[model samples]
Target: MDHNINTKTEEETITSTSIHQESKLLGSNKSSYKQILAIGGGKGGVGKTLVTANFAITLARAGAKVTLVDLDLGGANLHTCLGVEMSSRTLSDVFSSDIENIEDLCAPTIVPNLQLISGAHDSLNAANLPHAQKQKLIQRLQQLKSDYVILDLGAGTSFNTLDFFIAADVGILVVLPEPTSIENAYRFIKSAFYRKLKNIEHQLDARELVDKIVEKKEELGIKTPADLLSAIENESSDLGGKVRLAMNEMNLKLVVNQTRTGTDAEIGFGVKNVCKKYFGINVDYLGNLEYDSAVWQSVRRRKPLAVEFPTNPLVATMQKMVGHIVAEQAEKIKNEKSYE
Candidate 1:
């Protein structure tokens, strides 16, 4: 009897150790995936959500586990855009109730390897979510398990939008070729940069100078980012040094939409030149989408452009964009692993 008891105890101990070792291995694997991208623009009606949805779908179709989050709390129509109706739960439901785990709110979409975390649709409270709540939402988003997490942010330079954009691995700013959209896109980029500076305000004097530039632009219509940077440089050499470093570290991408001519296609290049010349920022030109009836048709059908019109020109543009984005992310991951 004593011999049998000893054998059983030894077997149980070995099993427990093996289970612990397996758990550690699984945890380590989970830690490897942390890429996130946020799509936003300063102006409205620039097809931000549509681009995000289609990009998420394309990535998922390519065997990636993608999560498309509708962060446009003011008008959360991403579910409608994706042709998904009556989600049993949403982000609001998770935040406002006892459901603390975000996975409970994740709704499976029609696409395999793709999931949708619908925003707070038609909810007044969602539009007015406090900064703390927005921060909490971002923290939860980081914990999500996926190869790519794309956030479709609301328009304008609201703190909510900037916070989400800054949290992302890639900040994609979408704009049309129209003058109004281009102007607003620049303002959005400046606001986003200042917001980032504020977050690291304690580490450098650049934050103070950037904030001053933002204030002057708002109050006096400085109009040119280069002029503002020059003024700051003249004020203090230390501030200028920090500003250059901040610009060097910026990871912002530009995407031009609704191109009608070669001139329209060159809008992205112009924007890139402006950012580099004035703000000393490097903006990646991720390509453009031509004006197509299929885009509007897909919207009317309540499906993503890529899904409804996979062979359209717009879809091709998006496919190329997604390929570049994926390659960039893979390179980043490889570099990180090499360093480790």
Candidate 2:
């Protein structure tokens, strides 16, 4: 994909920020200070792990400490992607008495400021991780000392995946330019949005209301989250307002990978628009990764694209996306402080 494309330039507004201040604020001892970025997709082989590994490298190279967590569960290979030997101290160790802290599993990588917590030692049923264990893992991840934590999530909309995706400060969904991929991407978003709503339905005292609305959404003419909120408002405006706030608070992003053409690169914007219209969610299109044979060559060499092919055009695109993410995150922090 040509980054020089006029359309690409018009679509992306890359922002700049001070990495020193970002590191100072985000790398604090407080777990809440850490920034969590979860990369997931509905279908497999959409380059989720590739994005996670490269993005972590980009951040680390930018002077921020980064950790890559292989939450892909039963099928973990992030270690292989980064050319790191699989460590004995994997996430599976956490389930046993031998390991008490998640940080104890951190393994160094070729990159200076990047660490990894591999999931390679997990059991076949690791994908079906117990809820309590998953929650504990998420908390520990937040408590990690790294300035940035990138989760390489498993494909599908399993409850575990949805919960982890929702737990992150930023949720990014990877998609390909095809019908099947697009459909699954939509399914993943819908599942995640409802999962979030379900978690807070009890708090809003609208469990039955939400269930009824979703069940009869077709009959009730509710097509989007906004439509459902309008229906709830008819019954109780206060509950509707709270639910609306929850919806607005969702931070999600879009990235189209393996783009072979300009139309493929444009898929991100199309997905973003569909999401806004169908789910009433604002998904930031974080640019695209053009299809490159070098990606596969790097994989065969067991190295991250950024490290193996430093001059690759795809690396430049990845850098642009990371810049936008950092700038937006910094702005978010500034806005929150003003409110405080």
Candidate 3:
């Protein structure tokens, strides 16, 4: 990958020479194109967007063509993080007017091999984009050509967000160690599971079982998946089987961010335990990121944490998590290809 080029400027030399050397040294390998990863959080202010942007840049720096899409329609700060000013054309223009191709709105970022598609800037339109338009946007994303497409999703359990999260090849939920964030994260996982079950309700007694679970939420105190499964099994075996299949096929991962101590690191373990004991969901605790001042400083400078502090502890943690996710996904793709 390292091809010496004639460059004079210091920036050009660093970008061309150093990055190529690093990519080669890291043994970065390419895979068949078309991978989508969505970074989401149930609660805001957990560094979801920041991590998304940096991780995209990191992948790009490793010689993969990456597209970092800002899907946080109401609050689009991804462009700012990438040091790109508001472009004339955005997803808003595509949705509201005569735009033939969604790729027309893609704007190049400062980082080579990385591009961004800004979301609608108009608060009213962004917040109220019809379901059809949202579906169209996702379809466009699916057609994008790149090794990886990382989506920075908005905080909430709205249908739009949940749909995007489920659509991703890998759905990473970023959470802090606080009690409220943990509670919200659990709720988000449960909601996503229920949503997935609803989508496949045509299979046997899935619909009825799900309805019973929802109707008796107060009666069953269904705070965990185990409780929900027990209730489902008691109510209907067919529905329970469907739910079990969905849970087994789930591709969800968790990342505990802003870790301050050993206790904070234990959050991921606790979540995994709760998920296994209660929901029958075996969530992979991908990794934990340490609290770093450099993260906040990079935000102030409108730069990604990975870019600003490439060797920082948090960046190392994120890179390790990304590696695990990528390897697992690559294995799945290879198996699929073999079956084909």
- In order of listing, the candidates' clash counts read 0, 0, 4
RMSD of each predicted structure: 11.7, 4.8, 6.0
Provide TM-scores for the models.
0.81, 0.90, 0.83
Count of backbone collisions within predicted model 2: 0
Model 2 whole-model lDDT (C-alpha atoms):
0.81
RMSD of 3: 6.0
Supply the TM-score for candidate 3: 0.83
The ten-residue window of minimal lDDT in model 2 covers: 2-11
* Ten contiguous residues minimizing lDDT sum, candidate 1: 1-10
Q: What C-alpha root-mean-square deviation, in Å, does candidate 1 show against the real structure?
A: 11.7
Error of 2 at 296 (Å): 0.4
- Pairs that collide, model 2: none
Model 3 ranges with Cα > 4 A deviation: 1-33, 203-205, 209-224, 230-242, 248-250
Task: After the best TM-score superposition of candidate 1, give how far the Cα of residue 58 lies from its true spot, in angstroms.
Answer: 1.1
lDDT of 2 by residue, 107-169 (tens): 998887899999845587678878898887888888788879999999999998899998898
Give the number of the best model, judged by TM-score.
2
lDDT of 1 by residue, 84-166 (tens): 77587887875687876787778877677778898888577786778888888888888888767889998899888888888
lDDT of 3 by residue, 262-305 (tens): 99999899998888897787788987888888988989998887
